[model samples]
Target: MRILESDGSIVDIFAIYWFGDETYFYGMPKNYGGLQAYKADEVTVIDNKIDFKTVFFSNDDAKSVHHWALIEESLLDDLLELDETAYKRFLDILKSEGQLDDNFY
Candidate 1:
């Protein structure tokens, strides 16, 4: 997801997940394992206003999170170090994960 910042810059958010009372927001650059995990409470406010409980994705959504983590640990650093082949494989994995059809060649 893309968020428009207050400074008129566009930021890309890869994923967001919740665990217990915590909400994790992933939006860091690819080379840094951009996973930010935080807790949200009744007093927690965004845009300077309190909000109600936030619904989270189902348990199955964990698979996607796990996959991304694996990709980061296994490929992110290598790809950033100029490994073109690893980059290609990373793209393939992403395509496989996001593909809705069988044409993921």
Candidate 2:
């Protein structure tokens, strides 16, 4: 994530997951997350949209969107204010959503 020095496809995948309506594609340590992202599990982490979805949360409903709305908005501001710790905050979310493997440590 070093400006133009970073990989563009990663940004594209993140954008598609955040904004795309029909397809989603993203690869990682093992090709996980987001809609249409091929791989195993086909369960946790959208098992289908490595991106963002309702099932990722518990007791989530239309009202729950507010939590994410705030997180989404704040992430940008937080990232701008503190790059060192900004990205780490998301690890917890991903872990809770089952995207990050427990053994990863």
Candidate 3:
């Protein structure tokens, strides 16, 4: 499992096999073009409340459309806590692979 933190919200990304069920992770990141078979599950809200749990990370060497080992899951933790330096490094990798663009938020 992989977690992305955007502001105070969290986005959960999982490979299909480990995802177990389809209730939360309904789709993949738009940039993936629906081919990578990974799911991005965003937090859901009811009224002014949000429902979610902090997910952790583990070491894995899964390859995607982009280059490998540039951004490693092992470097990230369960709280999805990436320091500014680490975040920038990860972002750079995404940008280099064209996974992030002007329209992404």
Candidate 4:
């Protein structure tokens, strides 16, 4: 993953694994701090630094948080263009957790 900075700069992105089927957005604190999931449609950026919010379980909730992350429009766009195979992998993980309703695929 790539984080887009306010000044159009891009930074490497990482994830903190957790249980459940939902995709989570975490705020990575500077200087090696623990990550926190974001809730609500809020995105915090201090002097171009990213901050945390809370986790959402539905698409609407996810979209709200996504809007907040749009501070870096290009970066958000890049994020939306996700790799299909990676997405499938995510679905696989969800299936393993028994989060998916059907295994028709």
Residue 80: error of model 3 in Å? 0.9
Which sections of candidate 4 miss by over 4 Å? 1-80, 103-105
Weakest 10 consecutive residues of candidate 4 by summed lDDT: 66-75
lDDT of 1: 0.41
Candidate 1 clashes: the total is 0
lDDT of 4 by residue, 67-91 (tens): 2322332233333344444335434
- Write down the TM-score of every candidate: 0.32, 0.32, 0.34, 0.25
- What tens digits encode model 2's per-residue C-alpha lDDT throughout 29-94? 222222123222221232323344422222322111212522453553443344435445544565
Which pairs of residues collide in candidate 2? 33-50, 34-49, 34-50, 34-51, 35-49
Cα deviation at 45, candidate 1, in Å, is 17
Instruction: Name the better of 2 and 4 by lDDT.
Output: 4
Residue runs of model 3 more than 4 Å from their true location after superposition: 1-73, 102-105
Candidate 4 local Cα displacement, residue 72, angstroms: 25
| lDDT of each residue in 4-101, candidate 1, tens digit only | 44445433334455665565544323343233332223222233221212233366435224335334447545544656666457546555655212
Q: Which scores better on TM-score, 2 or 3?
A: 3
**CA lDDT, candidate 1, residue 84:** 60
Ordered list by TM-score, greatest first: 3, 2, 1, 4
Instruction: Please list the Cα RMSD from the true structure of every candidate, rounded to 1 decimal place.
Output: 10.3, 10.9, 11.9, 15.7
